[model samples]
Target: MRLRILSADERLQEAQGKTTMALFGPSGAGKTTLLKTLPTEETVCLDLEAGLKSVQDWRGDSLPIRRFADAVDIACLIGGANPAAQPDEHFSEAHHAHLRAQHPELAARLDAKRIVFVDSITDLTRQAMAWAKTRPEALSERTGKPDTRGAYGLLAREVIGLLKHLQHAPGRTVIFVGILEKVVDDMNRVSWQPQMEGGKAARELPGIVDQVLTLSLFRQDTDQDGAVSWQHDAEKGHARRLVCQSGNPWGLPAKDRSGKLALTEPADLGALLTKINQTLKG
Candidate 1:
């Protein structure tokens, strides 16, 4: 085997091009409407939740994801194949070729776009979980009784693997949208997390994507010193804010691995992506 080394300039160029972001927020936060902010010509939305009803006036292309196979096959078509995957894996080189040969038009639709938006990974995970329940892992080998643990285990691997494959798609920017759920523990402590079928997905997703952002409402306020700050208040007049990094006062689930974003940005996905790419280039 021959080994090739990348120069420092080459490495920097490779790192600067595209972004993979996970955007989550509560229902009715206009998460779906944000798709309209993206450039219609270069963007394609994978409407997994059929949530495009809110953005009907927006002019852009969309693909519906109704089944588990649709999610996996579309991902493979967009991201191409994973040479490292086994032959049996859906993202394997062999499977990718088969899909391209069979559905050339479907492949072309995604290939023409640079941005791939997966609307609501929560529904995608539900689809995966539903499929997992029918697999051998969901049944006990000895008693043949239903095994929820096995199903959940399989579900985690499938969801995470799909996410990682999409993350590595060359020259493509991918955004995974998810519902953010508010959870109160038995001790009465409240926390917010990405709403997915299993706990593992929420924990693993922040690590997989380049950015984790939460979109929500915040009241514009002024302190005694007349310094402006945004606070989460129900009674005050509120506007949408995108929490881009962690340790924010709202305690939202946010992370910016690129270290290029401000703690808060305007709730515009297109502007945010442009800012990130610009910073990356600099």
Candidate 2:
């Protein structure tokens, strides 16, 4: 290797910027439905939820869904680990190994112009927790009790490692679907965030990706003072909102490294990208 000088224009060509989106919301808020609308071409969704019911009746060609059976299944699919060394005779384990052999590109997803969707980190964390139950180190055999802290730590490490893989994969866009959980402060203020069990992943969701937004169904309501406040309405068929930047009255966790996005927008990536592009133009 040698030190090389490049013009500003030439340096720009080396940039492999990719969009990393973390979308979290309550169930039935259309989180998976929105993901169904993403471009189908070159897209592969890690279907942790195990079905396309969110977009079952929808029209366009549904993207390929890779249903993962467990946390190890996900790890194998993503080529994060080799499962051949694992015990044989287990159908799920063997299936994971077979799938990995079939889809080596998943490990190198960032090099393509594809999008990888990890549908619902909430479920992924659950799977991680389930894995902890199998380990005697994590669960004592004598007492038949599980180590809560150890289980949480494992979940955090698994999720953080997955996030890192997608974040560093330069050319491809990666989207993580998550469920929303609330935390109450001393003042009894309720704040919404990703539902990651056990450890600090709930707090680190925004920091691990290029963007983090919460999808919510909102309703238009007028206050006594004639001011309107958009409140969350779990009932669908109404207003759908995506919170991009944080510190809003809604108190949903969100952030974007690209500061061009509005604080909130409709639940569509096109809208967000348009706003960002328009800002860049200005």
Candidate 3:
């Protein structure tokens, strides 16, 4: 038997199966709410902040974390929920080992057209930091510094590495949900930006994801009678408008707001995903 090696061009051609998306917005921007509309089969959600449970009438199939070592251990690893323990208690190494042992199955499910959502990467970062804190030697250099560079770097590496690994799997969609934070402009003005609490991870995400979508709601000026006279664009013309972003991914900015993408009404997540998939196809 002869061994064949793929050239760089061939390798690049083989890397087209994965899609990475980042959903970022303010506290009530409906990020998680939008997720419920995605196709349910083979989809797994890793909720860190436990926000997914807040949906008033979300009736979808969900897999809960019981033991740390199930076939879907990544759910627990990235979900950011403590495994039935108090703040002082720690998740044991046995749990990690169990997860490692079953990683192959988890990877397989993801490769089988399964969608995984990590709700709020912030909590995962916190869990990683807490785990790192237990190992002083691994994070000794950052003992007193509030920068959290060392800790966050280690955390980012792990999370990004895992994401990359999942990306390589045959037919998986990995959706990462992140919180919005206020970033101070050079003029000391504050603007809402995707919250990347894990310092290095926050800085590194733009380069990792294929697309980063920021969701926000803007209040329009109203008349003295409190009637909304006109709706305003969330961001002035300089930046891309979500409603009118290139290709109208959400079908939101048509000539008249009568179609599926109408921005005047509440966001319809199913319609939004359909439009996004259509945009991706185009």
Candidate 4:
């Protein structure tokens, strides 16, 4: 196969300065809470579980259809939420369009300062599955009907494409929050590991993300007088040490043999970002 090459001018204009980050952890580990602190106008959350509204207190903001086509400097919240009346129904295209229409003046703001957040792609997979079930034609394999897996693939592809586009934008950052799942190791009867839920989508994530951090809770015991000093990762057995660089394609080593990113008390997001920036700069 012959490879086609871009001209000098084309090569010069190609955008190559962008980074993506992924935060993975158990529920209630404060992953989404930590992400809320980043400097952004709006954190576009794709709430797969419909939990964001209750947890984050997000009200609908309207952006006209025309404006959405050219939106910049906007924080986009994209997520699937369960409807109040139906309880089982999740946010769909009609809901998304309604929210977009509420925020009309948002179009002219399309610049690099934008941020996109996908809160829990795992839930999105569930929503996709639910959507697929409603389409009988999509369920026929011989007719090329989409199954739950196919629906999931389509949704994952769309989300990933959106993430890629946002990352390519100058001064833009995209954060993906995923749920941790437990799996038993067949090779070692006593060994177990945690990972994201989606099959192929989860596998493809690490390559695209600039940083992958796993947040865990820790507790500590203190001497006499009941001085209980709490710590993060007390359950993991490493207590005294804080903030260990676990996995880095940039050569940063893990603090211990556990192969997990060790975070210090107070969870220093800035320091983590600094380390990542340095690696990219080098």
Q: Note the clash tally of each candidate.
A: 0, 0, 2, 22
Tens digit of lDDT per residue, candidate 2, span 71-120?
44444444333233345522235655576577676544522435667777
Candidate 3 CA-lDDT value: 0.52
What is the C-alpha local distance difference test score of each model?
0.88, 0.65, 0.52, 0.46
Q: Report the CA-based lDDT of candidate 2 relative to the real structure.
A: 0.65
| Candidates sorted by lDDT, best first | 1, 2, 3, 4
Candidate 1 wrong stretches, greater than 4 Å:
1-3, 234-237
Q: Which ten residues in a row are the worst by lDDT in model 4?
A: 64-73
Q: lDDT score of model 4?
A: 0.46
Expressed as tens digits, the lDDT of each residue in 175-260 for candidate 3 is 67777776677898655555654666666665666555556554557698988633444454222223423244332212211133
Candidate 2 TM-score versus the reference? 0.71
Best by lDDT: 1
RMSD, candidate 4, Å: 10.6
lDDT, candidate 3, residue 146?
Answer: 45
**Each model's Cα RMSD:** 1.6, 6.3, 9.9, 10.6
Q: What's model 1's lDDT at 221?
A: 78
Clashes of 3: 2
Which candidate number maximizes TM-score? Answer: 1
User: What tens digits encode model 1's per-residue C-alpha lDDT throughout 1-282?
Assistant: 346899987766776667899999888888888888899999999998888999999899999889987899888998888878899987999999999999998888788898888998999999999999999999999999989999999999999999998999988889999999888999998889888998897789999999999988888878899999877752353788889989987789999988989888988889998888777667
Q: Tell me the spans in candidate 2 whose CA falls farther than 4 Å from its real position.
A: 1-17, 57-113, 139-145, 182-188, 219-237, 274-282
